[model samples]
Target chain A: MSTFGLWHYWVVIVLMMIGLYTVIARDNLVKKVMGLNLFQVSVIMFYVSMGKVEGGTAPIIPEQASGPVVYSNPLPHVLMLTAIVVGIATTAMALSLVVRIRETYGTTEEDEIRKLDRAEHE
Target chain B: MTFPIEAIVFLFLLATALAVTHLRDLFAAAMVFGVFSLLSAGLFTLMDAVDVAFTEAAVGAGISTVLILSTLALTDPREHQQPVRFAPVAVVLLVGAALVYGTLDMPYYGDPTAPIHKHVAPEYIEGAMTDFGIPNIVTNVLASYRGYDTLGETTVVLTATVGVMLLLGGLGGARHRGDAEVVEAAGDEEPTPMDRVQVARVSTTVLAPLIMLFGLYVQFHGDFGPGGGFQAGVIFASALILHGIVFGLSSLKRVVSPRFLEIGLAAGVLIYAGTGVASLFRDGTFLDYAVLDHHSAQHGRHLGILLVEAGVGITVTCAMVLIFFFFAGRRAAKSEEPGDRDRRVA
Candidate 1:
């Protein structure tokens, strides 16, 4: 019911759409990879956002504190760290595939590459 | 307290994402993507995910940009303009609406009473200090409680290195390290444009060592602060990457041979798994750190975490640097091809 409370999730959804649209519509292979990157990063942002606690600090424990210290959830950060590494791996693998495609067809446009493949088949 | 800053940052992230989607010039889009990553890293900071922010800024902003640019170098940079496709737009809208509808039932941002916060997180936050005695709960959880997951993640990085090498032909010129030409290229500097910048050369010579030193600090200092194997590995690899950029790949090959990287990529994963196997032999279950030390379980845990993190750092550093070499080297190899320059010019 409150816009202020749900605004962050709303913005993240919009960002995710921008990424997904680029992936679906863009012809350029590199740009498609970039779009995929954007989508993955936004998902990471969503998880980290969900982990935050109002008034909580980073999860590093302090030596001494006067009051009960509230720490943001550490689980998401840990999981997202792995997710980011995996993201880069996926990007590298995809880009390398694009490089191979370019070398074979001498072009990176999806439709152009498809046309070349069709001609080869014919 | 976070409303003004966090809201503005979120808005900027949205704007950047839009720009990245619309930019036709691939080079410009790649540059803007770097900016997008930095902005996202800043947003992560605002959310108190400092470690995640650090890794994102390094991997997303730094490594991804370099990889994309190199691919552009080997392939093309201009995105051919096509008519705005409404089908995708409609699809995205439908999906976004569904996602928003789904979010309505989700807990609000930063709500401590959310189901996630009430789950296993409290155990980690409390147990990290008493069980492992590490100040950084994230590290304790990532390195110990979830050690198997991290091992799998490190293997994924190694797998990536293998894939890129297979696709790009054996680390470019690195396989022929025995070639006198490559050795000569390493022995003496090639007069390239990057080499002409005395200030860059001098600064890089001075800064590369310092950056690697800081990487070491991050590697060891994760127990008390916001870093661990993944971030440290990327940081260290970046230092070598900087050296390669400033000094040329030939010189970098002399510093880190391709063979070293090939072995290093697998070595990291082995080190991680070896720790588990070692613990199994020591009468504890896999990855049980308490068995590592005879005197105290805490001491054993500290030692085990350190060893596992080092393994992760080594593998990551190798995988990243190897990927860079393969991509950049392909460009060199293609340019070396007869008539390739003429074809490019035409």
Candidate 2:
């Protein structure tokens, strides 16, 4: 396999990096959640890409096909389906936490919340 | 070579991810994130992972976007100003570089001899018809061979729901407070009169039931197609959410009470665990459904898979609906609290 064949993985990696950057750099709690979601989704893409066969079709068995059919590996898809649901669950939980933070701190900014906490402690 | 549709889609995904990161307006960012999910789903389909694509489309593109928008409604949409931080950038780059370096050792795309392809995946593909009698090998592997992992995943979802409820205050626990105050507050301050929109009402009324029907199809059709309990649950929840969006949260609550949903959340988990225990009664190992029926092992496995999948569907649907209710309720309560906005300004 040539380097060109691995272009998909490289692009997915770049997306993952962008998502990671957003999660780390962004101040808004919601944006951070969004960033985390992007990072997760890119990871899912990478896994699915690995499961792809060069000339394979979808994993579903056809009714009338007579010849041997190359079905893409279904294991990664199965695992990633679980991951996607888990991702949504986590995102919902995170967003709810953000809502609570906003309500309690009167702000969603991480730094402001920290400062408020410091003042309260003092 | 033909037009690189996958490459184009990947580029779109990258561009959308960047846009979502840089966009200041949270609402626009949420919309862009929806597009990002849609494009990723497209990419998943292109890669022949149709089940994942369906799930991504429903949960990622549909429900998450709505949830975020609802969150936006409750909180401020504008982001706070922050100075450029170099440390995070450096860390992200370092980790990303490490990940890239790691991928170099992985087998090339879809090589039949790849380690993953040579493992249990082939067994699933070859033995699905004989062992599980299911056409969809993905379903066979997920429901039977990997039944324990899926059970764990369901528990994780249930745990997350409990955490959300604990943080946001369970709806059943808070119901006695009289949501009248919250509803009145939302009415006064909410910018859009979404409930009063005739088109939304008409469209949702017409579409909601159809979505529920599709959800059912996806649920039972898992043995043959690219769907199962997870996708079905999200679709079902999305239908309820759409109804809530058009008819108002209060109406939705009256129709499907929080207490019922809360019970449902636990009941689904119980059902899943119960199936495993039931198998034990038949002198089978935990979650071993082959002994579920005496006549045939395949028949027993089918029954077991169906019951467990239904359990998963019920739990997921209830969890999602309950979470939405809690978030919406919290937002409403916050809006009603006097001097809340003033505190932020000060």
Candidate 3:
């Protein structure tokens, strides 16, 4: 349709929804972490898409140039580069927490862990 | 005669994300998630974010898959069947609708006149040659223009290492399986076909050092191309990880000691911040690269970016390696002695 540009964002939104749905609805902690990662990647995609220019090349300047060139916006790329690393750091931290939870409760399922906590309180 | 590869990649990304969420098999989901990461990296390349794509492929697709698989080894792989709850689904749909609405006013996919391109981006793009004299705009901006943010990100990597160490003790906790158990386990069962894949083992031995050499190249060549410390660090770590998996974690540890990695983890952040402090001593403000060299600002910027990026590469490599060790080590310790939580054998 005429709205092809907007369609990109709409698809990204759909991907984000899937991630959010998984995180909210899944009982498995590891699955939730997967959902979190999905969400982060989609968000990165959204930002990078904004930085795209129709006729632009990558942001690296050529050593030998024939004429002026169009480079896609580099700021978002820079920010998202750091974000990707941060996303992994967050994933590593969350997964380790999941491991600890499994150790303490003997199950990675949320409802089961909650039940154990509730029963322990009594 | 039009091939819409971008649209195809996006569709695959959606399908993979859906599969990751829908699958009850956690192992399969993690593997599919790796595919999803590669698809996303492909999309990043389509969007001209080759540097980001490089990082995503290395960190998101490669190291993330390895880490998740190691975690799955230590935990249950089957996600217990849960009745789908409509409440959360409804909530997610509502949030999605709001976000879609919010995008109604956002600039189109490749609108060159968008506000983002109008802002500081032009300055960075136009000034890349004159200001930093570096061909790679992202590296110049990431390592120089936004030095503080990267410094903070390095610290975050260190923080993740700290949190992991605290939650699951040091890599030293990963002691080798007892000699008797190893012999008995071998005697108990016929060897699987995977054990006989000497070709893969031989290939990995020949390839791992080459991968490290490539990582070093990416680390040093980032000033001119689509790679930097983050991608290179992961590449280096993955090489070691590959070696560990093929040869054995104990053998891996012998090659690169656990103590050395732990020190490298903190040392990366120290190197990063140390550069800024050194800049301050040179009569420059925090992270001001212009004052580092008395003769030329260009040389100073070059030196500063290189040093900070080196720090980033060191920290990220050690951090990824240590995280892998912790997860893989926990599995080893558990297999060694079931139900023994005290693995404080440093």
RMSD to truth, every model: 3.1, 3.0, 3.7
List the lowest-lDDT window of 10 residues for candidate 3 chain B: B179-188
| Model 2 RMSD, rounded to 1 decimal | 3.0
Where does model 1 exceed 4 Å of error?
A: A1-3, B170-191, B338-346
Screening candidate 3 with a backbone cut-off below 3 angstroms (N, C-alpha, C), the clashing residue pairs are none
lDDT of each: 0.86, 0.84, 0.85
DockQ score of the complex predicted as candidate 1? 0.69
Writing each residue's lDDT as its tens digit, candidate 1 over B219-335 gives: 999999988899999989999988888887888888997679889989999999999889999899999999999899999999999999999999999999988887776666666
B268-287, model 2: which lDDT tens digit per residue? 88998999999999999999
List the candidate 3 regions with Cα displacement exceeding 4 Å: B1-3, B170-195, B340-346
True contacts kept of 3: 0.85
Q: How do the candidates rank by DockQ, highest first?
A: 3, 2, 1
What TM-score, to 2 decimal places, does chain A of model 2 have? 0.95
Q: How do the residues A37-113 of candidate 1 rate in per-residue lDDT, one tens digit apiece?
A: 89998899999999999989999998886799999999999999988987897789999999887876788999998
TM-score per candidate, chains pooled: 0.94, 0.94, 0.93
Candidate 2 TM-score, C-alpha based: 0.94
Query: Which structure among the candidates has the greatest DockQ?
Result: 3
In model 2, which residue pairs have backbone atoms overlapping below 3 Å?
none
**Alpha carbon lDDT at B117, candidate 1:** 98
